[model samples]
Target: MNIQLKHGADRLLFGMKESDVKALYGEPDRKYKDEDKNVIYLYNDKKVRLTFYQDEEFRLGYIITANNACKVFDEKVIGEEWSAIMPKLEAKGIRAFEKENFDSVDNYFNEANWVIFQVEFGEVIRIELGATINARDEFDWKF
Candidate 1:
């Protein structure tokens, strides 16, 4: 699928309702609710996790995936070396920066497109997307 990095899972986007997510991905492998009542949906088979905030009208708040076969804008992201993906990201005008005290890097086209790539031994092991108020605050402070 021609998944855009700006969106969440292939067809999922930020702010989508929980029912919509369920319709698209089926039942989650597991579900959790935090003190704040935010729901976390884990789809182990798909290697993806989604978090929705009840305070935010049950809108999607986060998407994280470790699936190596996942594609972003038709480009294979997982399992690819940073060197191979850097140019593609840059070509899309996405700027990347290494996070302090972390082994991962963050890439963004904008707030809605913010993504984190966790690296270990020079390979991207995980990818995270979506917006959290706290993250936006920190991002604003940094930029």
Candidate 2:
């Protein structure tokens, strides 16, 4: 919800090699190269391109496109057991449903890999899942 960064709130401002960029973000959906020989990282809804040029001192000058990014994560660890984990997840703004109705709520997280937590009717249903966004099934979404 409210993530406050003390210093480097700029998500795109990274200090790693070019090769590691994709590892930071998810795999790039597409790529493009400019006439100047620069590489661009393209996502489904976002794009970031990098350009390199030589300055007067022969130092590398770089230009980065799409300086801002939204960080989404699906993997997480829940410290408490089911009893303790349920309330915690709800506090984080995750919708809680009836555990007996787990099937009804499956679509919520199945369509989105970045699932912080999933609770059911004041009970912990699932936690600590991986970043695996399954294909959307219209039937599954029906509740």
Candidate 3:
């Protein structure tokens, strides 16, 4: 079992109970049933399969997958707004820069081929999410 905590909070990462998730993030984006009609909640671009079986320690076992996969982008965007929240940037971790105004970063974003930004309490890295492709299939940052 892999356990991940955010900001020292024992927040739910993945592979958690259905009830526990409901208590935390509330209703999911969508709900569905299997061939047997077992209700399950789909959250954060993840599909949590809840199975009600007999002769088992737990009636339900969930298969978790992020529901909006785009949440990574969302998190990065939010982290940008609150750059002060992060301490520094590192490998696989997010950090925030010292600049109070994001205009400079914004300018860099539009002017440069890649946008360099920090992830709060995580890491600092560049991204090219919206990069366009050229005639030769090469990425062009002109936009």
Give the C-alpha lDDT of model 1.
0.70
Tell me which residue pairs clash in candidate 2. 97-120, 97-121
Candidate order, lDDT descending: 1, 3, 2
lDDT of 3 by residue, 1-143 (tens): 11121200124432344566578767778767666555555554333233322222223332332222213322433224334323322233543223333533431122221223333344233222222235696433221
Model 2 is weakest, by summed lDDT over 10 consecutive residues, at 1-10
Query: How accurate locally is residue 3 in candidate 2, as Cα lDDT from 0 to 100?
Result: 13
Model 2 CA lDDT for position 82: 45
In the order shown, the candidates' Cα RMSDs to the true structure are 5.5, 15.8, 15.1
lDDT of 2: 0.33
Better of 1 and 3 by lDDT: 1
Sliding window of 10 residues with minimal summed lDDT for model 1: 134-143
In model 1, residue pairs whose N, Cα or C atoms come closer than 3 Å (at least 3 residues apart or on different chains), thus clashing, are: none
Model 2: residues with Cα > 4 Å off, grouped in runs: 1-9, 47-143
My TM-score estimates for the predictions, one after another, are: 0.78, 0.28, 0.28
Give the runs in model 3 whose Cα sits over 4 Å from its true position. 1-17, 45-60, 66-143
Write down the TM-score for model 1: 0.78
Candidate 2 backbone clash number: 2
lDDT of each: 0.70, 0.33, 0.34
